[model samples]
Target: MSNIIANQLDLFGAEEQSELFDEDAPTVYYHGDPDRVHARLHRLIAEARGAETLPWDQDSTRLYRKIVPQMVLWLPEEEAAQLRFEFEAELERMKAA
Candidate 1:
């Protein structure tokens, strides 16, 4: 496994085996709610698709602040994998387009 995957497993624990997207923030604060987490993921993916450059600082921070907390709280494992798959697939699609 890649260092990133290994690190994630170590951080989140082995029982929670899941893949996180490369774009995920290294440190996340937990809040609550799974449906909201999914929504934020969808929004982030959409923004990333439309964006020409990486959104960092306030814009990125604001986006992630909403999503990451919920992700950390509710959907640590599956959400990570789902987001990773979606982000990578969307990246590929954009590249092709």
Candidate 2:
């Protein structure tokens, strides 16, 4: 597998991202042991909040753009949205520099 796909799979602990989330649910739910899923989601959100740089490659940037917003869903609704907005804003700022 390509490094991008490999990295995503490793991070999410899922064979496919789609397999990790249910589409029909009002609130997305991950398919896994609850403790593992909770810990992983919290960690992803923390990483996104703390990151000052985009990943060093285009593929990783693409993954970050896609995943971080979803990761924020673990937060309260307003805070989650704000973090997603802030994360994206930072990415744009970095790209423009």
Candidate 3:
């Protein structure tokens, strides 16, 4: 009788033991190519500098405000700091206007 019940469970795809999560899984991060990132940051800086006022919509502005500084970290220390400073300065300039 027990063997028959086990066979029925097996036929129905029941598992006697299972884990809902795996703790040992490896985590992956994808940081884009440094030269590409640098170019993107430069373009963003140039666009902001060219604008007579804030260049992006409020949501886009907020997104850039939050991410640009963080993204700069993928660059060399000196370059990152320069880009971050330029981006922030432009934002402040636009806001003050």
Candidate 4:
């Protein structure tokens, strides 16, 4: 039965998604409180407070995005997208100010 076949396909064990990743891959992440990044950015921008060279420069912006994701064997896409949007909104507020 199709139901039986589908049930059999479920490994349903620890790290069942391990096949999706290569452990040796290089990646970046923010292991600390994600909100801290936004707070820090706001502080930095506030300190600079209208400088020509803002703290969140091109490389810094890249690092922001760079800090957002990782080579984890698993992360729900919706969770990642939510995190991405949170950071993007933080940056947008910085830019708007």
Best by lDDT: 3
For residues 23-76, write the lDDT of model 2, one tens digit per residue.
675775564453553566555555555666654478877887787666666666
The sequence of per-residue lDDT tens digits that candidate 1 reaches over residues 31-77 is: 56668767767887888678655444667556655655446446778
Q: Which whole-number lDDT from 0 to 100 does residue 55 have in model 4?
A: 56
Ranked by lDDT, top first? 3, 1, 2, 4
Give the runs in model 1 whose Cα sits over 4 Å from its true position: 1-31, 58-73, 85-97
Comparing 3 and 4 on TM-score, the stronger one? 3
Residue 81 miss distance in model 4 (angstroms): 1.1
Candidate 2 lDDT trough over 10 residues, lowest sum: 29-38
Alpha-carbon runs more than 4 Å astray in model 3: 1-25
lDDT of each: 0.65, 0.64, 0.86, 0.55
TM-score of 3: 0.72
List the candidates' TM-scores in order: 0.39, 0.46, 0.72, 0.35
RMSD of model 2 against the true structure: 14.9
Error of model 2, residue 76, in angstroms: 0.7
Q: Which residue pairs in candidate 2 collide?
A: none
**What tens-digit string does per-residue lDDT give for candidate 4 at 1-97?**
9998777777574357665576776776645553554455445445445544445669976775565554111345665565556556666766676
Indicate the TM-score of model 4: 0.35
For every model in order, what is the number of clashing pairs? 0, 0, 0, 0
Give the distance in Å from residue 78's predicted Cα in candidate 2 to where it truly belongs.
Answer: 1.2
